[model samples]
Target: MGSPPWAADPAPASRLPATNLLTIEYPGYIRDTSDSLDRALVSLSPVAGPRVDAASSAYALAHLTSLLERGGRVVECRLPSGSGVPDAMDLYKHPILGDVTPSDHVVVRVHRQVWKRMVNGQEERRKHYRIEVLGASSTCIRFRRMADYAFRPEMPAHASEHPTMKLHKILEEMDVAAMHAHRFMPEQEDYYDGQGAQRRSNLAMIPPPFFNRQELPFYYGYRQNPTSSLQTVTFASTSKRSRRTARKGDADLLDAGNDHAEVTRYLNRARWRNMAPVAVKFTEDGPVPTEPDAMLAQMALSERQLAYLERLKKHLSERPVWSRLSLLNQFSVADARALVQTKELFALVAYTFADGPWRDALVRFGYDPRQDMASRFFQRIHLRGKAPRAPTTRGAFKAEYGQASASGKAAPAVGDAQARPATHLFDGQHSTFSTSTFQLCDITAPVLLPLIHAEGPSDLRSAPDITTGWYSMSAWEAIRSSVSKSFHALLSEAGPHKTSEEAIESSEGSGAGDSSEEDE
Candidate 1:
């Protein structure tokens, strides 16, 4: 009934200032699915946003077909079973390639219907043709096709053509150009009362900021600061002119502007000022629930592995860290361990809003349901943090890690220690990467809803301090989808306070309810 808080104010008549563009590149691949004859080669690229990739692939195939037809070759086109778009592998087919010995030639099976002179002057006989389109580099496409009706063979001497060289070059260009035009969810904004004080706060949102590893020294703050971990990036979309220029098989016709839409950061923001408060499990005042065994089961860990994880749990549970900072609890332990085991990390995250017309918006944008676009925003979260700035010089590595040799005695610092993975695995004594891994969990709020992690069975033997946070299914229903009062009280208590030096000193000295002091 009303405008959502996240909606941006309409742009004025004047244009906004120019912003730098970010070119996000993704790898491409080819899949063969000739198992059912329904599909042969499916051109795939992980670059397009949501459904755009599939559509672009189909258009590319159509263009390839047109280029072949223009060469004055006998070409028979086969439509897919339904209203589905053209497939890359099914563009053309023939019957003769089945008999031809595999050789170094661009073999094509095409069809032509010719009128018969002996049988009947008006009757037409379909003939199968095999043409090998050769390229300058000896590369060839074994093109094949079947005629509408079986009749006789035409151009039986394995005809050869050379247009494939141009086709190959054209296809390469299309793949490269594919990177230039793409789309993604735009940034979102919302208003919030600053920590229970009766005023709104400004916040920006991005989904799935990390796809490989987390970068340490990166800050997770409301505004970009020296400590902020997330950086700004741009997602370019096809310009209106480019859309008009998109013609089948012609890469050069694509619009050059690649219209710049909204700019977004690499992370989502929680607007409440009191977000850092450490929560208790199953308590009315905290985020977790009363029963959490089911949640823990999802991690699928053995007792021994769970026991090892306890060290991390204990470290995170310490006073100031729990209250003032965010860390991975139980729900994320299995995922965390997996990251370490694989030496790679990726967590898929989706953008969520308190309440909005998200489904309708996704539909309007032509996103497929499976694209997870209806989730509003989708991102692959990478958890590994970049190694801290390489210690400035060679000695710095020794200074950072302390121990230089395997023997009991000290060894001379020679090469760069930072280059070693072992250097990043631990702190002076403890596992700093493990600790930082927990920190990453907090930064990326996996649970988008309001509910927090609840308590679990006492028999469980993993981390004593590490408890996972999840949405309280029962509590959520009991409240009739309303937020718990304890949350509101938290905001009231955590509201922004006086920032004058005198007030700040007094608050710091008191240390009664100050979560920030936990860091110190």
Candidate 2:
């Protein structure tokens, strides 16, 4: 097959430009999550992509062989761990902690046999299900039972001016019950009207431009007339001198560069864009699905006497941690939320193709996914616009409602930027930070690609608009360059247009045909 035009290595394009480095900082109540184990693990180069640590579960099903002074051995469940990385957490064990061996302070190695056996265990059974299906797994049904216990949005009775703290209090009290939702789906604008498009859009194949969210000011807060975001940073894989500094197995960083362009605006400092977004939920062509009521049945915010899914912050908070993590049953949720916000803020940036700072960060810190890499970086963030808040009153809230707050607001949104962010999240000397350079395209594309390529949900391709032409690199253009020269190259190279209007069946009773029209 002809080379996949859109495919590019995620690194510098062999040449070095000294002007690429940039320092971006922001001002506002920002919550950073690299400190948390769960989030920190996402930054690691392990797993399918960045994901929740295998060990960061509601319970760590460790098998303990404890021996008392009497020389009797007993086993029991260990307290669930909050640490995020499965690899790091895999190191510490109660036996190791309780070891009476002479090399007490040493980081003794656990046998691979023992380690595998310890982390090994079946997931929780779906006892939480409303009803058990003969073939359904336990994990499948528990959300129905556990919904009441997850985080619900929390709104305070009295209005508060601190934005960060208010968000912190609100999230802490909310129940973000878990769901088995398929995350990011790419727009297949890059597809070269060939078998790929005919069989499935695989969204990534379609070509489009990126949206500069700063264009819309709500997420940016008070920022305005921000500097143009430096555009695509191309990385070369075989630079003689570049290899001088290349890591042992480093690949081209260009693809990562392209992907970041789609996501960086969300991470750009809010001071540049000046906006605010109230809620986040996950959705599709229609409205976002209501969370399972079971997960919403119990929540931490409800215990605080606050209303559910409520936002009471009118100002930034002095305490960043509180705004981020105090609310979730698992540390992963809070960490994921914080990363999403940071990414959204970065998205606001408008990059100029000539010199992209976003590219520089990747260069300094490579984003290649190696299982052994200690410090990995993840730029993917998901967000969605929430429905308008329903009218609410403090008086209507019921004491026994079982919801975090009884305000009756609509559910918050989840994003697909897998839509990534902006904001000062904090005040600093500069609105941005200077970090290692990267292969932006590689980072963004490879992650979503599975959804964009061979096996992604087909519908995921057509609906979401990736705004490809707007991107400076036009990685799509580069990809298309490999495919053909013209905008309608596929029409010329493959065959005639053969407009589907002539082929589509017009039977009036065909609901499936009507749905296809809706998709179109």
Candidate 3:
């Protein structure tokens, strides 16, 4: 049961191109390969967002981070090797961005002690290319979720405060409309403002989760990293505020009333004017936290949330409401029986006009086609593996009337048509791993109908098998007859002693010519 020593080779030497960065004479001390590599690497990322990917909390902690501008270069002020500034100028300008030669390194340092806690033992659920290095290659890079897609802000009333925060607020207020409106464009603003008619601006409306000062500097170097630098949905947002301030006066306006009043006072008053270093405390969470800080943390639930769930649970326990629901809500039914003290009141609904009135109502009322086509519908059928006690939606129909046979070790039941549809039933009663996966296979369905999706690997079943049995024998006879006729024709063309006859005729002609020559 233990892991073997052979399983733990921790070297990535195969991924690196060369072990060292040799300063060579190319492209005015060109990073031609590095530049090209970075662009190619970043194009594959899925990390674009306002600020960060929150759910990737586990992975982001394990690695170093940086940003990559379009042109291949790190723009951070200092690097991990502690390079103060990069050593090239022509590397700044790109053809698309009109030549921006890579010129800096972005450095972010976390104590190596805490590094293991973040990235260790995560189960990888996706596929990615593994970059192999050539020498003393200690570089371990992977595309954190890609983040560099262009997104125009829906300019909230307060967007000018700070771009990322504005986006954070927008996401917190996320609706289908806002997400649907999101567009990814490649071009940033032109380098010069209107061909010198106006002032030039280098600032880009970087999507939410901008990098820290040290991070931007190292952007170019990280861009070329094939393994991890691709922007992806996995690349989460940065945790802390960098040293850079978005605006001078805007901070005061944002911190108007609460706890940061003291910090704001220090910023505002004469003490700072004479001499005040203005102490600042940084937190992973923003300026204020929900807890009062007397206790380390609080488990206190929000009154609104607790009350809503409580009353809703209570109402469902009542007679008419309880009778309306199906067996799937039994855990609540059990709890509701305990809460209001009435099993008679919360008796599960036995049979109905429709298996699910509410879901049908949603369809009747008009659900969006995209929402109607969402995978959740498919999962409801494929996931149950056996059928539910109450059936609703297209997936239910697709599973029952459409599927051929339950072939998976874990697929839903492929019972005959006589079995009652059981969409109303609870999942646990039929959910044993022995009978757990419901797969369907080896049955023919209505011709031209799409087959039911397999729930797992064991569910792979072949299409209706059409045996080409007796027909193959008849085709063989036809082939035999054709071959016999061809053989006879070939024999006729070869006629007996054909080559000898031609030789005899040629010899006779030669003899006659000799006789004539002799007479002459």
lDDT string for model 1 (13-68, tens) is: 53333332211111222234543222322222112222333634455446445634
Candidate achieving higher TM-score, 1 or 2: 1
Q: Estimate the TM-score of every prediction.
A: 0.17, 0.13, 0.12
> Candidate 3 residues 1-520, lDDT tens each?
9888977987643233333321111121223486543333232233222322221322322212222223232211111112312222212111111112322222222332212233467743443443333344222232222223222323223224434343344566876676566543344555544455754433324443333212123345434323322121111111113112323543443332342332111122211121111111211123312112222112244564354335544543341111222222233322423323322221111111112211111111111212231211211111212223323335533432334344766765343223323323312112111111111111112210122332233332122111211113233233222222222222323232323224334434444221111000
Model 2, 124-241: lDDT tens digits are 4322223211221111100011111111122222324223233333444563442123123333253343354433223212112221212212344665446434333224322234
* Candidate 2: segments with Cα more than 4 A from true spot: 1-287, 300-308, 312-429, 434-463, 466-520
* Highest-lDDT candidate: 1
Q: Rank the candidates by lDDT, best first.
A: 1, 3, 2
Each model's lDDT comes to 0.29, 0.24, 0.27
Candidate achieving the largest TM-score: 1
Model 2 is weakest, by summed lDDT over 10 consecutive residues, at: 138-147
Superposed Cα deviation of residue 355, candidate 2 (Å): 27
Question: What is the RMSD, in Å, between candidate 2 and the native fold over all Cα?
Answer: 42.2
Taking the candidates one at a time, how many backbone clashes does each contain? 30, 152, 88
Worst 10 residues of 3 by lDDT: 357-366
Candidate 2 lDDT for residue 83: 42
lDDT of 1: 0.29
How displaced is residue 47 in candidate 1, in Å?
51
